[model samples]
Target: MRLTRPFRRLGPAERRIWDAYPTGAWVDLRTGDKDTDDPVNGPAWGPDRTVRAEVIAALLLGAREPEPGRTAGLRLAGARVTGELNLSDAVLTGKLHLLNCHLSEVVSLTDATTSGVRFRGCEMERIRAARCTVNGLLELDGSTVRNGVRLDNAHVTGQFRLSRARLHAPGERFRASESWLEDARRPFTAAEMKERGLGQDQWAVWAGGLTVDGGAFLRDLRVTGGLRLIGAKFHGGIYLQRSVITATGSHAVQADFMEAGAVEFSAGFTAKGTIRMRSARVNGVLSFSEATLEAPGRTLHLSHAQVEELIWLPTSVKGGVNLGYSRIGVLFDGPASYPDEVRLNGLTYEALRGRWTVAERLSWVCRDSDGYRPQPYEQLAAWFRRIGHEPDARRVLLAKQRRRRGTLRPTGRFWGRLLDLVVGYGYRPWLAGLWVVVLLAAGTAVFAAVPPAQIDPDEVRSFQPFVYTLDLLVPVSVFEQRGAWEPVDWTQWLAWTLVASGWILATALIAGAARVLRPSAGS
Candidate 1:
């Protein structure tokens, strides 16, 4: 298409606008026949037909000249605007709406100030709204931004809706992919997302550090590149329901240190990269009930995060989820079928929401199978005891002990196993007493056949076996039967063996008694 210089001929409306705003260069964009030189051949040309960068900027700011000024407002539809929409550092009070319009270059509002500005169903080269302040909403819904939307530090006073918007343009930060959402009508709560998960082949958007004063709705969005919202904050709830994002290289949704009211990735939400929420603070529930997180390492990197409500992940994670050093209200809120997959090291949860019994709960805590992690078990046991779940608490501690035993050397582990059998780790003390009774009966029978006169120098008769056995076995107590009686050569060996048996039985009994004295473990 051939372009002409600033319009040599202007219609009545075009002349009026050019005369009022004489500082801009209006060009014949030649988008349609409406800007023809002859009015009879096509639609009448006017200020609306002008496709100049400065002209659009002045109109958006309600200025008659290229410099910043105020006017009633501007609402242009099906218009063609040329050059970058550079409104940076300019202040506009009225609503500036550009509907179904096409831009020739990037829309740069970097560090610019404005009120309610919207570009519904418009086609722009790109956008640079970084550090801009929108006193009202700055919407771009149903629009196709070719390059990308850079709202890194932009502040929006009202709601920010990027719902169902098409974002393209691979950026230096992340590559771009087509947005293909799986489901769009589901609720933002992520309730029905169990079994069903997210789907995405590529990732696209990278709007990190975005701050929204009002509610933010990213629901039904589909991105092909990384949606890096690291350190982003919203005063209200952030809905990511039915959105699919991929992390070709970077994280799919890296919202680290983000603070929001209710941040959800519930229904039909799928992510390929790490959904990092490190050090994030959510005032309400941060749910991913039916979402699929698929990063190989650190799939859901939520370390040091504080969520006020339960962090749901029933059919949620695909690769693995890391909650290390995180503080959650209810840590595990789903099925305990495969507990070994979730990492809960250094995690502290107030309540556990699993249908499993006390043993099952203990089993879930040790699911990582990453060897003995004393901190995880200790933290879990402490939490269980705090809520008067004494039995559960004891079970957890027992699990910790067992886990620790498994990692010991062969000799140490064997010794531990011996203790487990003898007294059930001090769990059963009666077995020690039963051993004493059996040993006393055997010793009494053996000594009854031998007479004390032949074994001793003094003239003593046959001894009472029961009395003699009692004196020989009771090492700590004095029964005084062996004082005057002595056994001959071979008989003396039997008596000495009995003395050693007495010492062994006494030690076992004391050990069992000590275990019984302490708190009892759950059955």
Candidate 2:
């Protein structure tokens, strides 16, 4: 009978020799037994020769050891491997690397690590580890470290430093959520220090949930994406001086529900994003001296929060510092008000314009306070005397005197009645003069209307024409009524003449007194 192709190709002994070792190793079984088992313990191969997948798997999985004193370079990419593979204390001088190695099946590198396991310039598609651990410093400094650098629910019992590392993928995320960086207590010496960019061109360190209880040091780091510190707690001061944050999210450095001792951003810190301190309680001062915020849409919103101490903005703040509805314990008085809250000494309206409202408000308050001062009344009286507004000034003085004497009552009704009489008669001096003139004219007319006694008229009827006219003007019945002729009872005429003279004198006195006492225009 003719054998089948695969069965006839390999005999029974050859099949038994092939089944002796693991499935992905490449070695000749007929060469030697010791050589077949230790096939990777050999010299290096050139770049043209293909490295068998079985040998590469055995070497990486620690099932076979590479030869000493000879440097070997192997690239196991796109190879399907199963079960746990450990590559601890392996020395590959010329780049022992893995690219798109499908290890979706069960794979563990627990306590199996390398010195410079550089995935520096390659892309790690997806790596899922259950409880895998690394025991050395894994340096991926200048690499496109991508896609969930997550060691979720795992333990890293060594120093894990990824300084100056970049995240390439769009939503590149990292979460060492519950794990701790234990060896972070060791101080970073000068040689171990990482250089910082002066915000020229660099990406920020993006880590989803980073917890360093032993105090992580990120002195002058830069970030191009959002840093979410959601439900994180730190016991150290987060020094972010001279750091540039260009996060696209709401908050550049969000510590939503965090408890920190102190957060200091002293020297030349800048944020091109909104720093939200919503529902966060800071025990100390949130000082931002010499710091600049250049947010595009809405610059630096600190709306609803409670600051226990002071929120200082002392340095040159470029954008609008909005403390619109925030509550401050003590706001220091601005430069204008030095001593008293009421008095604004040396206040100038021209100096303060469009800068601060406090200056203008204080100036207005000072002017109002000085306007009601009692000294203005005296000063106005003196000014009126100097500037020829004396009449108005005297009126003001009289009004002020009346206002001052408003509470005092008059001593007697006699004085009150005298004042009323004086005021009523004082303004009418011409009326008194006219009354005297009328009384004199009436007396003269009455004397001419009545004639002298008739017996005297017959005895001295001398014809002086002026005297005869005077006699004719007088009436004949005047002497008969009086029973006398020579004097004709001149007492009644003398009494009328005396009353008119007295009234004329009184009118002259009244007019003189009114002219002297009245307020002059230049008073």
Estimate TM-scores for all models: 0.72, 0.32
lDDT of 1 by residue, 390-469 (tens): 76665576566667778889997885666555554554555566666887787777777764444455665656878887
Query: RMSD to native for every prediction?
Result: 9.8, 28.5
What do the candidate models score in CA lDDT, each in turn? Answer: 0.66, 0.37
Tens digit per residue, CA lDDT, model 2, 1-523? 3312223343332233223322332222222344332213222222222223334444444433334544333343322323333342333223244432323222223333333243332223323322333333333333333332433222233333333333322231321212112211233344333221211112233332333332333334445544454434434434555555554333455554544445555466666555655444445555565666654333344434344444344343323333333444333323332212222222111112123342343232333233332222333344445657665445444333333333336753343233223332233344445644555455445545543444455554422222422222233422232233322476355433544455444544454355336554111
Q: What lDDT is reached at residue 436 by model 1?
A: 65
TM-score of 2: 0.32
Q: What does the lDDT read for residue 148 in candidate 1?
A: 61
Maximum-TM-score candidate = 1
Pairs with steric clashes in candidate 1: 89-112, 190-267, 198-270, 202-224, 203-224, 203-225, 204-224, 204-225, 340-367
Candidate 2: residue 212 lDDT (0-100): 33
Which model scores highest in lDDT? 1
